[model samples]
Target: MINVVIADDQTLVRAGFRSILDGEEDISVVAEAADGAEAVERAASERPDVVLMDIRMPGVDGLEATRRIAADPRLGDVRVVILTTFDLDEYVYSALRAGASGFLVKDTEPMELIHAVRVAARGDSLLAPAVTRRLIAEFVDRIKEPPPAPRLNSLTEREREVLAGVAAGLSNEELAERLVVSIATAKTHVSRVLTKLGARDRAQLVVIAYESGTVRPGWLS
Candidate 1:
């Protein structure tokens, strides 16, 4: 089972999430918190597999708490899924940079919510294809340059190519077709690129690739 913690400032939100998750056979709500500080404290103790977090909260807030949880090695690979009503790019940017494994609007369907949790638990990502494109367009509109190049020293040329393709929102299947390889092989390359770049997931890879100048904005369109 995927052990989870629900952290939000509103009791109703927490209760609602708890209700949605409790019905899933593959998941269990191990704990719940109403504020970021309490969420951090509980996270240290409970060490859940995933945290469903709200970005806006009283004290510390979800973003900072997520940073703390993500930075601490003692958390032992606990992943976070930013579950919030707001889909502000800043929140998404901070969350992805902080190593959150998933991002979803709170109004997301119950099934999607559950899937997001499962994806986080498995160390996969929930940055959908459409979200990826939207993220790129949003970033492009805000800045002339991508964030900043990630420190990539040892990556192979092939890995770099795969990284660029990913920045264009190419799914693994699409990547396979483009690279003339099997889907599994494409996934392997993508995973290796992520590991080399210290990216949390494909979304982070895309951001890093664009911002770092690994992939140019010219190619995005």
Candidate 2:
């Protein structure tokens, strides 16, 4: 089962999420918290497979809580999915950088919310294909220039190419077609790239791709 902890300051929101998730046989609502500090405590104690964290909260805030949970090696398997009412790019980027596996708009459909949790639990990034380009564009708009390149000495040329495609929001299937390889091979390449780069997940790979200039905004469109 995919164990989860719901962390939101609003009582209604937590209840609503619990109601939606409890209906799923494969998922369980292991705990709930009303604030960021409580969320962090619950994470340390319950160590749920996934954390549904609200970005805005009283005291500590979800961002900080996510950072704390992510930084702790003991909670390495615990993934966080940021919940926000707003789709601000800054929040999205910050959450991802802070090690959130994914995020969802608060009004996301019940099924999508469930899917996101499952995706996080499965160790895949929650960034949907349709939003990937938009996310990269927003990152570009926010930064005047690319940051310094990350140390990519360990990557093979094919791995670098695969990394670029991932930054472009290409799914494993799409990447397979683009590289004329089987989907499993593409996925393996992606996995290898992530391992070499020390990325927490695909979202961080996207961030590194942009920051390291492996993929640039102008390269799109």
Residue pairs clashing in model 2 are none
Evaluate model 1: give its TM-score: 0.86
Best by TM-score: 2
Q: Can you tell me which runs of candidate 2 are displaced by over 4 Å?
A: 218-221
RMSD of each: 2.5, 1.7
lDDT of 1: 0.79
**Which candidate gets the maximum lDDT versus the true structure?**
2
lDDT of 2 by residue, 1-221 (tens): 99999999999999999999999999999999998899989999998999999988988999999999988989988999989886755776788888888788899999999999998998888766456556656766667776666568689899999988887777899899999999999999999998888888887888788777787776765
Q: Which lDDT value does model 1 have at 130?
A: 65
